[model samples]
Target: MVEPIGGASTGALVPPDDYFDVIKHICKKYDILLILDEVMTGMGRTGAMYAYEHWNIKADIIALSKGLTSGYFPVGAILTTDEIVDDMMEKGGFAHGHTLAGNPMGCAVALEVYNVIEDEGLVENSAKMGKLLIQGLNKLAKRYSIIGQVRGKGLLTAIEIVKPGTKKDIFPPEMDVNHLIADWAFKDGLILYPRRPINGLRGDHILIAPPLISDKAVIEELLELLDKTLARSMFMLG
Candidate 1:
């Protein structure tokens, strides 16, 4: 079996470290290939060169995008072991190519983005501030009935919203509680992702992925607004 993985993904595993170890063991036993999806969590988004690197585990392939070019230009990469590359080349050079894939302008910009990330030490900063953000959210969860859980590593975190008084009953979209929170957050100058479940109205969560360059003060400001938004939105859901 070949498994597709994402860093700190909601459905994959929690705490990330454990997930890597567990998957590595499973792969060893089942002779499976691990394919990591690093689009959202790649290129220092999770305060590591690549999010998977933090786990000290290796994968057979990794699909990277999003922060790879810092959103300056559209581009993506398929990083894999030499065996995979050799096999594909033997089969006659990647059977796919996009007109814009090798654009020089995009390549140049992406290079600069990499340099900026390294020079400014944004990845390390992300690691530090991400911890602060998660800690703060956990504190907020202590006082709110609507917050079911706070889980994430680095700048990738999520706040799961559930019905205020129902132990395991999820929030219904008829209420759009996540939307209410997102709207409030936007007005507060902090844009966030209120994710949809694979199916409508099944999952309710606000995914938080701030810029890696954010500092403690910025995180505090964002969390302050987030906390306020949570409070007001939770009240509205009821």
Candidate 2:
């Protein structure tokens, strides 16, 4: 399974330009099943209705949740090709179901969520605002030497915090720079998702996922708040 935008596992990491294309080629060559874990990057999170759409990837199966019901209701879904499902059905059953499987309310909410995304032009907004997000984060990176890298696709983005003047060098893990940055920002009312890019063991980065409905003005205010947090972080490092 793969996260098209890498999600929290790799700190909103976007694969290289050729990575997905190459993977698709390899999967086709070997007749391998290509599955995508789109729980975080789906439902218009990665500037597209589905992150795989960015690469025109043909996935055998795709997992989705979170954005499906916009958190108004709990729901999850799996999308697979007819070939796969038909084969499973013919072989008896997949035996994969939940107690609330196909619950009416959850399904209804998920459908409305998609409609809202379209009506609000959130997908388009994500693509436009996403560029601003990356640009804003890059500016902060330029000012804060501790910021090692800034990356993401659409609103699903993050910054890798590093020891200043060292190429991708991590600080003492006890310092917990990721959480420190997030905590600092939280005090100012800007919530950030902190994660260890290196498998929860080490490495510091914070995921910044602005709401799809966010406007430029809101994003600018967010960046201003983040500026303050980074300054505090710099002081702590010093």
Candidate 3:
């Protein structure tokens, strides 16, 4: 079973420590293989080398990409225990191949990326900047009627846009309020992830994942732009 630490598509984050404890225990008891998909949350983006490390749970397998080469080169990796490798070898090797399977250039670039992350302490920077981001977003939530929930972990965060004065009163799909806010932000020189309807429902959310190297000043500037954008969107929607 594969589970993502912070769901990139949905913009929802699973609680780190306790939640994984139960999952790890259940999977162990049932002799199930636990696979962690860290493609989005890996390589110091989530304030750690891997988000799963925050839970201290060992997965049977892990998938990694994107941050592997810091987007300089396309590369991905799958990791598993030695036991699994031995079993696969006995069964005539694992069945998987891609055009870039053994690209030496990609591997070399990925290694350099790792060195940069470690040498510059990007993981710690992510944690610090993430806190600033959450604080700023929460303040915006209090000030803006269109803002609903503000939630996320590390640098992965989300804000749900809804009708004013209602907890879960999502705007109708046709309104596309989330998209409007994103467009306004973009025009103001801030690029955010595209809006998404929650669980195919009317509720809309936008994800905010700044680069791991971002600082508190940059996050504050982002909040300022977002605040202006939301105000404009709310007036237009109303």
> What lDDT does each candidate get?
0.77, 0.91, 0.82
Clashing pairs in 2: none
- lDDT ranking from best candidate downward: 2, 3, 1
lDDT of 3 by residue, 31-56 (tens): 99999988888887777788887777
lDDT of 2 by residue, 1-238 (tens): 7898888888888888899888988998998999999999998988999999888678999999999999789899999999999999999978877788999999999999999999999999999999999999999998998899998999999999899868588988888878888988999999999988675658688899999999999899999999999999889884
**Highest lDDT against the true fold, candidate:** 2
Q: Write the per-residue lDDT of candidate 1 for residues 1-238, one digit (tens) a residue.
A: 1223233335222444476678888988998888887877788877687877666788898887778899978878878999988998999978887777788887787788899999999899988998999999899888787888786777878888788766568865787777788998898888988865646565678888888889989999988988888778767775
Q: Could you estimate the TM-score for every candidate? A: 0.88, 0.96, 0.92
How much is the lDDT of residue 147 in candidate 2? 90
Spell out the clash pairs found in candidate 1.
none
* Backbone N/Cα/C clashes per model: 0, 0, 0
TM-score of the candidate numbered 2?
Answer: 0.96
Off by over 4 Å in 2: none
Off by over 4 Å in 3: 197-201
Q: Which candidate has the top score in TM-score?
A: 2
For candidate 1, report its TM-score: 0.88
